[model samples]
Target: MIRHQRQNYDWGINAEGSSLEGGAAQVAMNGDTVFIHYICRDEDGNMVDDSAESEDHPVSFEVGAGEITGNPLFQAFDEAIRGLPLGSTTVLEARGGDWNRELFFEVPRDHAEIQRLEGRYKNQGGLQDGLIVELSNGGSAMVVAVTDDVVKIDANNMLAGKRRIFEVTLLNIEPAQR
Candidate 1:
């Protein structure tokens, strides 16, 4: 693969200079704050996540750190984002990684609720269509499947099996203090 070159760097969200792009990327630096709007999608072109959810949802991050991009689509993003101007828009195709597939439990569950909900859902349809199960305690689980009398619900950070596409624009960047 061809090695891409470093481009421009900017200081803060309030740049007085005109927009920056490809060849003009020398203005961008690792420590410079970057303001961007972006959308992330799966290889099949389905929307995964996007900054467009709200006016304040655009992404902001230091140029080189790995915080905002722990997903498998990092390389494609790094390449596609190269030399993008402040207001420019870009789309990145990302495949889900293990980190995106692992389920996380926010609240502990006793075996009783698990058994009850599973048994109630057994041989039931509409599980995969999506069902929200309200726990006796606060919070809910999105039911994904029911089989062998087992209700297979996964609460993971990553949306499973779906391709995600993202539309992004640079919003703001603040380099962290050393």
Candidate 2:
């Protein structure tokens, strides 16, 4: 594997730039749900995710509510799409690291959060291991460690501490209703 050079950027919402592709009068707006194809790679140029490879490609989400992605980096990415016409694309080079070091939390095995998580994930696979949970703060975290008395959850991105390269193309936009 070839290691790529790392680039410096602000912690959250560090937008490198964006380029509009074809000529389209329609521009992504605040309430519109935008569809986009994206590829994520690490500084080493390793592919983290590609929307095209999965059935979830051309991901769709409302521009305003995109903050559901739950990170300053992603929030900025969603914000960048607003006003971009169809066929436009954007680039974000985010530095990988625990945006919040406090992401590690240990909760009692019988805590409400733990119970709720167990109930929510029971059908999927239960909270045994490697389960992703939605945080009250809106960020998502992976179950890193589990024990009889306590469960340790880490909200850090899997690629934390590594520079990430995101190339996103705006495929389509659904206008707001009402």
- Candidate 2 off by > 4 Å: 1-11, 20-24, 67-70, 98-156
What lDDT would candidate 1 get against the real structure? Answer: 0.49
Top candidate by TM-score? 2
Off by over 4 Å in 1: 1-27, 40-50, 67-83, 97-142, 146-149, 154-160, 171-178
lDDT of 2 by residue, 1-178 (tens): 2212222345543554444444546888988989999888887889898999988887888887756766676676677677766776667777666556687788898999889888888888789778888976688898978999999897888667667878878899889995
How accurate locally, in lDDT, is each candidate? 0.49, 0.76
Point to the candidate with the largest lDDT.
2
Tens-digit lDDT string for candidate 1 (103-176): 53322233577766656666674345377776556556676664545555556434344445555565544534
The 10-residue segment with the lowest total lDDT in model 1: 8-17
Cα error, candidate 2, residue 104 (Å): 8.7
Cα lDDT for residue 144, model 2? 78
TM of each candidate vs. truth: 0.46, 0.58
C-alpha lDDT (0 to 100) for residue 37 of candidate 2? 91
